[model samples]
Target: MAVHSNKTATLIVMLGALLLSSGCGNLAGHKNVDRGLSYIESHEYEEAAACFDAAEAAGENQRILYRAKGILDKNLGQYDSAVENFLKSLAATSGIPGDMDFDTNYYLADVYIKQEKYDEAVEVYDAILALRKRDKDAYYMRGMARLYSGDHDGATIDFNKAIALAGRNYDLRIMIYKALSSNGYEDEGKAILESCLNNTDPNMTNYEKGQISYYLGNNADAQSYLELARNERDMDKAPVVLLLGQTGEKQGDFNYAISVYKTFLAEDPDHPDIYNQLGLCQTNVGDYEGAVNSFEAGLALGNNEYSKALLMNEITAYEYAGNFAQAKTLMEKYRKAYPDDKDAEREEIFLSSR
Candidate 1:
């Protein structure tokens, strides 16, 4: 699973306005903080860290500074540090709930989720909802936390509330289904998805319909819808191509999947997730070297969400190519980076014998 970054473009813009209005006394500090956030959004973590350091030296607002640091730590998978920094940010707040407060709480909750502290995550979301009573995203996230914590009834109620608030939102519906289906509630998830298919929401785009069809096992319809959606102007092609490749894979056509991924990469080579998918397709076709190259290419794009998966897959590609020595070497590094991964532990044992 990928670590979600909270430094979105919208948030960055909001923060920029917030900092600028704080007066000319801390102008340099504010600019540094803003640049740090921009670097974070671009996945340039080292540059972001430098910018943050400069911001701190220039005496930026303590609350915003801590929150920005927390975001950085979270993106870098330092969950403990993230939690601590987020708490510090909250403590530095002026006892008034504002956008920064909400952002910090959301990021803190996300880090809690990453650490598998579901109850803590729920509490954070609860606080968020107490302030913003009609926040559908908060309800949806709380539902996930409840589901993960085994409070199925609470989860169901929250999910329903979220759905009620987000009328005709196919994306949110599909996300809700994914949360349920991945956590031992497949039948319930299927029912939610079925409702999407049956609803005559005119605002539903081809991509939304395709996503619903894909999850519901209607791959043919998914492919047709996704292909049409891919051609629409101003559409984000990454997701459309990704689903098309996945649909090809579901239909037992690895070559088609590879072709789809490669074509997309030919046009926009910056997407690390696509490279990860392409690498997996190559591995499926016994092109281990190609898989390794693809995975490495993705890893070279800085530490985005797919970095962990890409590194693991690269190690797997080496193993599949009969290069046990290289695989074991990579496994040692992987273990150090992700000591909690039980699967990696087992793989290490297997690789040791090879």
Candidate 2:
């Protein structure tokens, strides 16, 4: 689909391939690895890592452990760690299976692609393609890698192959369109996006369509599709709302932004941003009293990163309500709390002169 331009997905895919290719094993190794999983389930990362390490050292399912650890690393923004773990997984299966498992290779390919190792990614993807002729993601991702690597003809072939297998997948189609456009086929590229959106029975996923709409400056349609996708709610339901809120803020639709931010806060109140946004929206609507209340509520939560900026907001709100005495009190407090903030110090100086 639109793919969120995430690096993690590609990394995970490559890591998956390596694990499947090399991680399958005998009884003792499996058992040790299973113990590591148990510890992971208990939220004891250190204990789990230790168990996995033991399993790895004892000739256990190092591949599996490595895959899990790679995923963990990716989630924690340790891309380098993920790459290391994934490479270790690959090395584990280098000669044993005689070839890469399509699944693991697919993940490995994705990871390599994210890391900008196009040739390595293509190598793994090619191996996967050889193993499974109809493997759509393999063809599609390789095509993308090739496109980025200045191999337009090769990229086109892989993309066409992916389309043949997964024609209904709009993401692949869009990539092909872009490739065509880059290769001096601008009319075809434009038509591709338009044709898919206008399809009577569009095989494309919702997010893919959303991507098309977003790029075309149809923010309403883009948001509508994205919201539709988020309705599935596989997790805390905060992410989708947060995304919508961000969009609304960007568009200056403060009321809609407030609604989305409020929904997000309902699920993740600990997030200071929602409060800040709510205060901002209320301030914009001339609801100064409400804005003050919102800032006060956020301050009470005690999580503000830009505490002085937030207090300055409060000062403005107080100035609006003609509460100069309380406003002065807060301004002094702001100076005390954030002495290093030049803006806050300047504002305190300006206010004291008044």
lDDT of 1 by residue, 1-354 (tens): 333333332232223323332433233347787898888776677898999889887877767887888988887778888877777666555435578778888888888888899987887787777668999999999999999889999999999999999987878888988999899999899899998878757888899889999999999999999999999998999999999999999998999999999999998999999999999999999999999999998999976578779989999999889999999998887776565467888999999988
Considering every candidate listed, which one attains the maximal TM-score? Answer: 1
Best by lDDT: 1
Report the backbone clash tally of model 2.
10
Estimate, for each residue in 254-342, the C-alpha lDDT of model 2 and write its tens digit: 88988877776776777555676688788887888888977887777765464545678889888777777888899877654443356
What TM-score would every model get versus the actual structure? 0.77, 0.50
Q: What local lDDT does model 1 show for residue 77?
A: 79
